[model samples]
Target: MHIVLQIGSEITRPTFWLIGPVGKAVFYYLAAVAILVFLAGASERVKRYTKGDADHADRLDDLPSRVVESARTVLSNRTLFDRDFVGGVMHLLVMWGFLTLLIATIILGIDMDLYRPLTGESFFIGDFYLSYSFVADAMGLLFIVGLGIMLYRRYAARNERLWGHHTSLEDDLLVWTLFLLGVGGYLTEAVRIIGQDFPPFETASFVGWAVALIIAAVGVTPELARTLYPITWWAHALLALAFIAAIPMGKPFHMLSSFANVVTRDGDAGKRLPGIPADLDATNAETIDDFSWKELLDQDACTKCGRCSSVCPAKASDRPLDPRNVILDLKTYREERDAGGEDLPIIADGGAAVIDAATMESCMACMACMDSCPVEIEHLSSFTKMNRQLVDQGDVDSNVQNVFQNVMQQGNTFGDQARARADWTAELEFEVDDARETEVEFLWYVGDYPSYDDRNKQVARSLARLFELAGVEYGILYEDEVYDGNDVRRIGEEFLFLEQAGTLVDTFEACEFEKIVCTDPHSFNTFKNEYPEVDFAEFADDPMMAFEIEESWDGAPVYHWTQVVEELVDDGRLGLQGDELAYTVTYHDPCHLGRYNDEYEAPRELVRATGCKLVEMPRNRNDSFCCGGGGGGLWTDFDDEPKPSEERLREALEDTSAGDAIEKFVVACPMCMTMYEDGRKTGGYEDEIQIVDVAELLIEAVEIRDGRQA
Candidate 1:
């Protein structure tokens, strides 16, 4: 009884309120110090992220498209969402709730305690204070619930990604501390309600009243409740301060940065992937030469969510590249370099902790990691830049020599005869390249595949027929066009890519064609995005010449063959011929054509216009599955394993209901078409289905109707 009475004395005395004034002064001072220090540190770190380059090439106009892309990803990659819905929703609620509660917390501090003590009517709407109270209390409750779910998942649920390094003990301690903070806050509210005689606090203080009743049932007197309130409130305030100050050092830092990063993501789906620049370009390359320290700070933006790791094809295929771990590696490297006051070593300096060659080799340059990152961290570009540093500066192991050898001797990855690069175009009635004439309307860039591969020859033939039908005069860079080498550049042969791109740009400069088009998205991406660097040396060069713009003809206004077909159909310049080729077909999205170029709808539109019945695949458009032909994977052997095409083709067949009614698989990419053909053969579905390009489908439709291929 004496202990209870002593506690009551401390609680009810006006002197207990002294803690509020003293605590406020100390806390605010500490908070200002913390914020200032963090601002300096974070600003310094962000400079490292951009590596001292203030010109962020992220292209702000691209942010909306990036958001839409991320939104599209929500449904496609449901694994991340499904596994952590409650935790995620709770997390969002807590985040949003904290913002609202922050306003209330400030109001309580300033109006209730500072402005006019004990006035009780200083709120935004004085008498209707219940609404503010309810919102604050309700959101606070949600914040607690969300934190509770997180704690449960961390300690009890055993989620692999979250606990990959087994820091469960420390993490659990943190979780418990946070939980206690919440509990103490709620208890303080209950105590205050029980002791105070404030009106308009009836139903609004539901949790407080319930907590008061519980304490009363346990034989706790009003004196005990009053005594406990001050201590608990002080403890809660301290915990919250600690949490805020700790923000810059943990994964939760992403809570503040991810939205910012997402808002600044690349929006141009049509912007071609920029290529390595040449000599004259180097003269104006100050932005590329001096990378800012902020370039290095980009590591801080990572949430370490592991969503990138889950979708990584390289990791899935048993390679060493875990994109999440790569970001972690960068973070660790940055920390050690800064702490030691030493220059970051060429190979991520650390004993027994450095990333190795085997780990880097596992990356197929797929860019899926970059695609999935919620923070828009650009892991692909970072990794490639590191590779550039490694090979050029560190003398690290690489396939660069082999790539050069292939391009120099064979002119392709397959080491096929360079002479045969234009074999498919041998039968074309028109001349391949007659730059001397200089009056062509279209410059058809017949890339290595459609020009050589017998299977892709049909696409070449269809393109010719379509051109003839449209009365579009087009020229081909037959022998003049060597490999554009975007894949080679991405895989770290930057020099070779520049040389090849340089040659292509020179050839285009000499040509008189009004417009250029290519069947290959890779070639299109290269010529349109990279080759133009030769002209402007700073900005993307326009592939379309003046006549093409005026007459709409010179630059490489590249499109998937389907997009061209759709445009032709829309203009009434082209139409489906006979009903004989009509069958239920499904379209597969190639990573380069679908995700890379934003050509999802145009291909679907073309397929629908073909007069064939169309069926939807479970993973179509931006959500489409990779056909395993991208990032030079089509040519490189993967552990002597069966082709990725076999698996992808099997998936497509299942989607098209090939066993039921579909007789053909229509594709727009030459690589995809080749892969599907191989897939059909390997999967024993050759007799069941035939794979053809959308151009071929149009040709078949037209030939069956007009008796001419177009």
Candidate 2:
């Protein structure tokens, strides 16, 4: 048999099987119908998404930036790889290989239909054609390799992430469809090569060449191959079209939605919770239509990889809050609502609610879900919005209600007299300057826990001494400041939070200070991120927003104490004696400071500056476990078994112990100190470990001894 090289012809087999207009017409009809079906399904989803509130339309404004960001997110695949390298590699291979094959198919179509008819010349020829054939063959095999890994993970491997979730039949069907599609494609190529008696140059498609040789050795006649060619060709074409149509019908929709999710994600989502809308009563989302369009879009975007649940402190504590389930449930509610079913409340009366009130309340707003999500879904915001509806309806638990009432009536969660905010000042060696009485360089905003909690009062005093030693001209807001409303807003008490934040911003504007410093990460996050958007005039007439002055508070520069100490140390203003302390210390990253604001290094550097050997917990920095004190978790104990704080303490204890078996568990946030102090006692580690704030540890290293400041 002689081989002929058709160098200037298209790489693909004859379009319409070189048969006639009938075959060409049929292929076009099927392809067009498949495309139309996909668009129809996708359009329905888009309509459902638009049914949500209009706040998310802003995401559509910046086209170029969105495209760049979305492309970067999809191409980098950092979210998956950062957590699990092996799984990330497998996904990257499959994702890129699929894209390459799709591109090849488009090029082939253009070469045959557009270029060949216009110029009577194939665009893919010579070295380019050979390279294309080689790459297509190699990528096909790689695609199969990826599918094999996925199948093994789903069936053979003990993947706990996938085990608990409801694995639908649709998921299995999607995978099998792709697998068979790949096989059919490669087999068709092999059979075509054997039947055509193609040239040696065609062997550049090595996988097809090898398979063709095997088929020839098996005594498959050209006549038999010719008959099989048309069957395999049409089957492969139909399968490809079917895959496209199936994309928007099931879990496969994630391919498109996830990319859009990354592109259109709120830029400052995890950094700041959404502000309560101007019309407080009407803004809370009670049902599918009430949710923001982005929230609705998030439902379609979720891949159900279970990463959020895997890292959730609430889920680990056996609490009702499962981030993954929350997204899935919301998705279900939307689907049902679109199907013309009975209108269902997202947070219903009983435990059987689509998303129960208990589940909404169970979240600690630790932001693990938001951080771990590959598609950048704002899980925390979704839960908070649902909680907002519950709060408006007076459906919150008694403890939560009381906490909200305390903030409204007392300006603090402790329900203490506002005057007592400055009581911690009495313990300092030198009277701390009052920002109300005099202009100061730094206005220290002592948060609720540090001002009222006895254990945290020591931390406040320690920070005061450190400030004095460093000659940092700082003064406290004294009785003038109210709660920062960080956790209050997160807990769904929007009106109460607005009142508190408005009052605080009013005081901040009245006080003459260059910068604001916070003892709590929560307050720091609130002041830095949330307060700037407050419009005080909107609530001026309300009793809770009773401030003498008006005008929206212009944005103020704010710093957490850890940030201040780190800056001071870096600038050589705050000197450490570097006395070698005989203790092993591990630093815990508070949720607000680490994940919410990305200030992990500052606190750790302060710990290292204290002269103690700094040992890291397995999950430190951005991945650090929550201390069960954020998002009103400190105010209302949900009685969750194996408390998150206890779990964290156990992790701290696992670090290699120095003298006295890791003497200190240093923390930066006052809330963290409060949680861990109680955790140390309840976890029975009081004898072995001590919970010390970073400020307190810093003072120990910098404190004056023998009439000289260290």
Candidate 3:
């Protein structure tokens, strides 16, 4: 053995040092069996996905883009690091370390078993061997370090997110076994090094060399080391084999399932939503089979990081909704059904149901779960599907029923008559143009709450005045407008949304507009993302209208009014008195605008353009807390205390790193304005913080305050 540099063999270690050919053959057989076991377990889960109702071809159509995006997501660990830095580092280290070690194993296998025999020369010789050993040991150390951190996080520090009902004994054992596997590999290397008298090139294996020194200091002689090398080798190899075999069968399956889920995620998932294509009867989600293959995989992909539940406003507000448990309950039901024909509904009328009705109703459909999820589980889709099932069964509470009826009967959620849709405009001294009759640069889709809710109507009038004062060409649909259906679709009234979308699309067809705009982010989201995908052929009672829509329109560019006002401010068109309306304000990122549409910057810019010191809440942008206004929460009342909006108002008024208690809680969406206003009154924070809209602030600062003045 080469303790120092010898002629040729110093760079590479013996491949089969203590093990004979028979022992090597036995190891190969065990490895092959492990691979087969992994395949059997993984295939079982794959077969379940085949039963899903989703179009497999749709997810697979953009294979290249999916592959690239998935690779980026996995490698960067971007989502993991969003708000939790410590947890992110732990995952990144563990994942990359494991992946690198796996790649090293494959390289060694091909080199020793295939390449050396075929070419009569070692592919992993000299420089390559040294490089491989160095990298492999470093990554092994990283793997061990990461495992240690995770153990500390889970048990010692007791990070609350890591502990939940989803945690099990298997979760604990999985981490320990993986940690031991990495340690065992290092021990095997150290013993081998001692037996070989510690080769000069082997020093490149820094961790193993250090371990070899420690063992030598402990009086383990070379002869004893030689005796223990084979035993240590077999122990490590068997443990590794067991881990491999259990990958898809147990908790580690997240490695494969998560990657697949991320790859198949829709870029516009919660924003666009899945449209019911052929059937107006309604999209059904009675069982796991009703979901898509990607969605089925989504449940399996959950790592139980509790990120979704942790960030969820509904869950934080003491609502029964928990995104992690929702997915876990479905997974349990899926396994039960697959194993022994378990016929229980995923959600049903009583306590016997897999997920409780209260849990289902508590969801705000804010997309926080999906945004916070490292694996892209699409929790909103699951909630929406389950809600659809409830809607189909008429299992929802009375408030939800009334809200749905209001939208169905009166073209809005307030149950106001059709003529009342444009009543807000009566307060404006200037007559707003009917977009249907006038060609305008921007067609404003004045949504339900903005038109009918008094406070929001005041804000809406301010926006109209701003448009007039800026000499911008914009018009509203007036009484012809209906619910934009963003919330209707989220509430699982698919038929209602389709009809509403058809009516709006028909109304849009009559209007000659260059762009679309709205003060309500929900309407903006539907118009920008969902409405474009609405198959009008599956639409309203008018057949001719469908054909016209199909031919004339594919999609439209829709903006939140903040974006328009920000643009105007940038172009010096709003004619603002600089710093005149300055106030310390914190902006509430409407879920539809921030998470669903990625329009965070525009609202903040508008706030800054008013010369206010923009103070941001701890949770802002995609991470912003929801105000409990989404997914029909704005219309349907919840009996729960400390509403999400009220909690958010409290959070907004806290002494942030940037500023102290904010004077104004600025918002861009009408739903947000309404929710926070109500929250302020109920929470007794009305005097502490003012609920104001960006439009209202801009109007006060604008050179002209009203349209009549213009």
Candidate 4:
């Protein structure tokens, strides 16, 4: 608003009357050119901030169509939309104003001389275009107000964190400066409007007009207003120029970069994940060890909205990791490097003030934040890579040493043998061992919990019954499978995860399974998405593409128990033998199944097929509250009050439709089973509802029909 009034131009206009059109033309051109030059420099700085090490292949693979679609869904998706609107509304106003202001400046350049002489009639102003001028002025004012609110949010009110505080002095100053730029620019215009009392005042004057009246009422003569206009205008102009120039200097730069980042985002952030290369040349001497500057700087694209922090089970449980800070830290660290500040340790750097080990650990790699982010910042991948650098390439800490030792020597997170991995199968009537030698149609990659946990043993049994009833040629890896280490890798054991994934991949290479499915979503996610990258020297694979391969691999189908059960009903193969076991059950979505993989519907569909009336939880489907077993949370003890699952269970139980209490709460993940069980205990729901796996329910349905058939 201030910039448009051209208060300085009004003061200079009289002087230009003597110099004629040519001199005025030269001055406007120089100012326009100055703005462009500053903008270009800012753009370059943002580019430098996000670039990292060279990716093994193209680091980004999100397709434009998918990115656009996901962005649309982000707005509609309630979970993402809830905590986002305040920030989104403020940000959108500022962003829209930025573009509008740029266009206005370009128009000023044209008005001065680019297209017409400086003496050209001011045809663009006045009541003829009253709506346009009024809108621009209103938007400009709105932008200032938005910036004020944003600054308050970022500084005075902020979330707790691990490394440095969320609000820094520089961040606060940036917001204040941006806000002043808007206010000062508007005031300059108001001064000019009051000085000239121009005929177009009615249209060009909306915001500035009232201020002009106030100045005139104070006995400020037109000549005095004229004198003050140029100084205020120049101050406004200089501040705008400075803000433009400072774009790449700090966190505020995301305002400009977020658009391009969104357009070029990796779509697999929600639908899938990146896959490892299958043909990696382990011996490649030249090409396998580095990440590109762009790849590394990908972290810089973060808006610091803390969406990742909110969904992070680790952070929720008081773990140190915060994805927002991880990106901010890396960006700061990169900036320091560009500034010749690389020699200084990152932790000691000002940027490191926002990042640290706890913030790093708080990330669960659930990708909830990744899916929720409007700009497609890959926080999970960035954090995982940092974990790789610290635990794999750098000196290992004792905590990491302990994890690796347990995984390598013990074969699982709990330091148990593979024998325990199949211990759950012993309770079932069927022998679900490997058919690797017999062209098995399905290879079930059962993870540790389902195998060893007594409660989940029933899930193992239910799935077995469902598969047998469908007459599918599915076989288990039995004792051959090891932990997928998805959680371990996410929790800062990159090398250990690599070792575990490598062992599993090797086993797959030796065996001849047609298709693979795992009861563990983490195992499914890692094997389907991350394992191939165990060796990155050869062909680099995109995880999105890998999903297709995993879907169609070996001409055999891989299905979660839900998918298979759904197929059974679809194919007319389903036979429910049990008496109508009428019970109200509420389903708790596991972060892995619901958020990570977006497999929300299948489990519910399975629940319905059992003829049990489904009692919907308050947070169901994609927005289903997490059970808090993700990111090695099952392994971590919570001495802190209000455990995540206890909170989640309350949400689930609160949604009962009937006066009758919920008798059973079903979940799909072993981790969820563990968590909800603890939640049942903690929430004192142990006497009210039993948390059972969906697989176990299907098993009950099958056994009932089997007896009738007998």
Candidate 5:
């Protein structure tokens, strides 16, 4: 191969240099060992993922599309670049360069060792060789530059996202090995060029050729370069082998695991969580085996970017939960279980654990972490499963426990009489329909917060008046409606959620309605995605329940009131003119509404329909900050001072005061109305930004229409 390569005018360097047969043999021998080590470790990790449930519907449902999406996601690096531009560029350089170099090495291996040796024909010379040499050197330099940035961020700049919660020597080792490997490849090339009498065609190895000039400029003779060549050559080769072996042993494993995680990601993961399998019960997962295979895969896929923690409502409010720590803790426990360690509580705080009870409870279940996570680890879903275990184990907070009890016992979170669910309508001049008796277009599932909460009740009453005035045929469940169990399911009270969902499913079976609608995103989410999956053995005989198999709207059509109102306003029946009640208002997206269902636009469209100037917060739409209202947030207070809602109010405040005062912080969800209402009062921004529901705004528009007509 050396004679064949040198005879070709030296456009490409030798695959091996200044090494005898014994050296080549040793290199191949170590290469085989590295391959073995990598396979053994990788197989074990993959085996762990497989041990969990393999029943994920979205995992292999659309393999072609999934593969295409995965390819697009990785290539575009959108998730990696979510909030950090420099980090995105850094990753792109490293990822593409590293992948390219790997491909070049494989091509060289096939031509030099496998293909050319057997076929006795060499196509790896001439134009292809020259082009390959230049490309390889250029990519290697890029790879080194990326590594340099990463190391600087880690060690010098001390980027919190990289260094947060935990840092192991293996993490540092993986990075340094990659950095040195790139550096060593160029050094080896420089030495080889020194020995080859500066072949003019060697200019094709542009970076390496420049390195050679520097080496010769430092007064090293060609004879001396020849003496130093073997050491540099072996070092580079060994470093490359080490990289392969070390892949699954440290953070480098994310290269494979994260890609697979993204490819198999559930499009509606946090929004529509996987159901617990028949065999497993929700007890705080004592061991890794308790989690589903996909959840196990999620743990391995974490890149520790801390985007989750940074965006976490709980963590920002001086809460104990660090979203990154949740994954890391689970990962450490898995490692222990693999090492034959006995099962124990992973959530107990204060004693050598990555997560604690406080941490678990601290999660407002906003899903900010999952949304911000580049790898799509399904953080909120995994944590919810663990929370189920906690509830079953009686390790839940008092406030959260009360919420579960109230929801199950009273058909609502307030523990009020069922008749009280309809009491809000008494305040309205017009009567609301009982959907069970009357046929209606929308079966309004009046969620607990909208019905029972004093502040939200006004918003609900206003919506009723607006509906009546618009001649919209919508009726509510009234006394029969149970909590939708969206947040109940998320808060980890699985049995409670099922029981409540079963009751609502049965109610739907009896009701004559075209669609289910809610002022609560939580209710809308469950009715839309989860209600159909409930094993309603009692209602099993029905060919179609009202909520299920709706023909008027598509599969399991459920909508937030904003969606219905958007259509109503578009019809021009409401007579909404933007100038009529034009108030410069910013909108706060409810987590369940925007991030969960991808319904950010409907509410905003309604705002525009009402003639309000829709000013936006910095974090609006999918990236909108949570109002500390989902999951168990409505019932509990884990933070020393409530921050998610108040912090969100501050963000809204910055977008206003253009010429007139910001009239209102418009919201679409009842839970958001409650949260931001409290946020305005506590954050001392009551005078600065008003909290008003989208329904309230629409009602105001309706009054304007009525006044103009009179």
Candidate 6:
């Protein structure tokens, strides 16, 4: 009988050799088995998430918004695209091709089993069917191309981001399985096209038609082609089933977990650190159950991309910490526990620990890892949580413990008396108003280093002069202003931070300041972001709470001095008076201001406003390198050969060495100033470079304009 070809004909392939019924039955059975296995494995992995503590539950409050954001993140691949464009494009192409093919598969199943059976006619048989066929064929080719690129990247290119660290058999399995599956699919389509008597319109399936033409030129008879069709079809079908079954078995599992992670990510990246539990002596998280559910999900969501490790300052400085390995180790521990292994100690005596203590301490809490992470994993939170446990166990570094003790006893990391807080005001030409005894428009919250350290005190004095020149109605709390506790909180001393913050909040309540401003980015970050959640009842009767401020303090507005200076220059409040100094300047972005608070523009603007030639370091803005002073690094010294600060200094010097050279390395944070000053002397760049705060630079420019010696 002559087969009739309908318009756009969906019946491109003939029935199976073992009869259509048998073929359909076998296909459905295999599909069912594959799906069951996939779901079972997925469920087991999901169950482990419940072992973690509750966190980011608020993420579910705005479900629709979260879904839209998640969809946008996935479809646009914004995180990867913005950070690594080439790799992002490769990933995007493969992702789109796979999704399109998945849709085509579902449509084909419906057309074969439901539409044709019920209507006695194929739905995908007309112009729409031809279009669908063309699309499917084109996408299949695209998928193959994407797979080839991935193979090249993994093997030929040997991408540093992918290889050279902790790769496993599972990683190879995932790539090879997908590669083989794509090849098998394309070959099956070619065999079917050659065997069947398809119409001219069906040739719109270009790749398949081309393959068929090649087969025909090879003298393959129609009968031989038909014989090969069933063999190729079965092979393709089994391979597809195997691919689906392996989705939740290994690295391929990221396909699902990553999407879920993106959807459930914390809305506020700046406020990622969870508050310490109220019980001061409460046990830290010892097991997987101790972490928040989002944190546990972080383990599964990690793509092993090594982006986190690549940007980690500690890792770059040859510290014991490798963020990628830390996450992978946690994942492995979870797998072991799920497999009925003994409860593995996260930090054991002699046995393998999930993460060693040294790695935990090595974290600088700079948020670089979190910022670089495409999946938005809370790596810093993990470090802090683990550190909290270590602290409770009295296993913290001696320097860190000393910092904790000083902050608790002396209200500052330096153990200086509260009376010495306003010592910097002594050299100011103008008598600074005391906010405690008078109302002021701006309350200058001179943080620990600016108030106590000699070098930082000079910067503090310069800032006070700038405030005066701008005619800003600002005053200091003097001795009443205790430490803001930004570093203390980060050091895993939550209770002490609370006490310090509470005392400061109370003092602010008594002061008649409209807004609080600080020269230190650390203080700026803490007051603006963290203090609102401080519980006052705990410090109500404590002697440390001796501040006389009485009104309800719900965290007033806070601004960094850079922000204030930017406003002053914009408003024409501060006039630049002196000759533009002939100096090449490079600005260092402190971690808190740049990444933690997203305040990059203001400082750079302030620098440029001074008429100094601003040369940006290779890494600036959100990608800026840390000075190793954050996370209590200022007080707690590590045995790093080239400290993070010194490393950053070298980067600046190298950028400026060729030309006019960097005359000054301008900074905005007191901690950064301290770190880089030491870096200047230690790195042997003291003759070539001088470290100064943005305020100092601005003051110099202002003084020169006034025709006075700077």
TM-scores across all candidates?
0.80, 0.95, 0.94, 0.79, 0.94, 0.94
Q: What C-alpha lDDT does candidate 1 achieve relative to the native structure? A: 0.61
Task: Give each model's whole-structure lDDT.
Answer: 0.61, 0.81, 0.83, 0.62, 0.80, 0.80
RMSD for each of the candidates: 6.6, 2.4, 2.9, 6.5, 3.4, 2.8
Whose lDDT is greatest here? 3
lDDT by residue (tens digit), candidate 6, 1-710: 24344424344433344236878798889999999999998997888777777783475778788889898989887888756787787787778888998999898788778987898876665667678878888887877887888889889998776864569888888878777777777777666666665457758788878877887889876677778877888887898898899888888889888888888887565454677655545556588778788888888899888888888898888888888888888888878787898786675323476777777777777999889888888787777777777767677788888878877778788889988889888887779999999889999998889999999999999999889988999999888878888876776776677777777877777779899998888888888877765556645555655544333357788999999989998987877632456668898989999899899999888888888888889888988999988887777667887888888888887754434377889999999999999988887878878899988888877867777544
Q: Write one digit per residue (lDDT tens) for candidate 3, span 1-710.
A: 33333336546777777798999999999999999999998998888788888642377767998899899989989889988998899989999899999999999899888988898877677887889999999998999999999999988999888888879987987899989989999999999889988877789999999999999999988889989999999999999999999998868999999999888887777777776655545357776788878778888999889999899888787788889988988887888788886587767657677887778888888999999999888887778888888888888878878888887789888999989889898888899998888899999888888889999899989999989878899888878888877887887877778777777787887889989988788888888877767766544445423224443248678888888888888888876646756588898888988888888898788777778888888888988988998887876667767888888888877656544457898998888888888899999997888999988888777643343357
Clashes of each: 34, 0, 0, 31, 3, 3
Question: Candidate 4's C-alpha lDDT?
Answer: 0.62
Per-residue CA lDDT of model 2 for 1-710, tens digit only, reads: 44234644545345454336887788899999999999999998888777788763367778898989789878877788867787787787788878889998998889888998899877577787889899998998888888888889878995667655545787788778888887888888877887777557778989888888888889876667767888888889899999898788988899999998888887678557776656545757677778888888898898778889889988898888888888988887778767887876678547556788777777888898889888999887788888888887788878888887788789999899999988988877799988887899899998888899899899989888878877898888888778888887887887788778777877777778899999999998888888776666777776655675455777779998888888888776666655535468888889998898888788888787767888888888878889988877887767767888888888777743443466788888888888888888888888878888888877776653323632
Worst 10 residues of 1 by lDDT: 544-553
Tens-place lDDT per residue, model 5, 208-241, is 8999999899986688888999998988888889
lDDT of 2 at 206: 92
Question: What is the overall TM-score of model 6 with all chains considered together?
Answer: 0.94
Candidates 3 and 4 compared by TM-score, better number: 3
Residue 388 of model 3 has an lDDT of 82
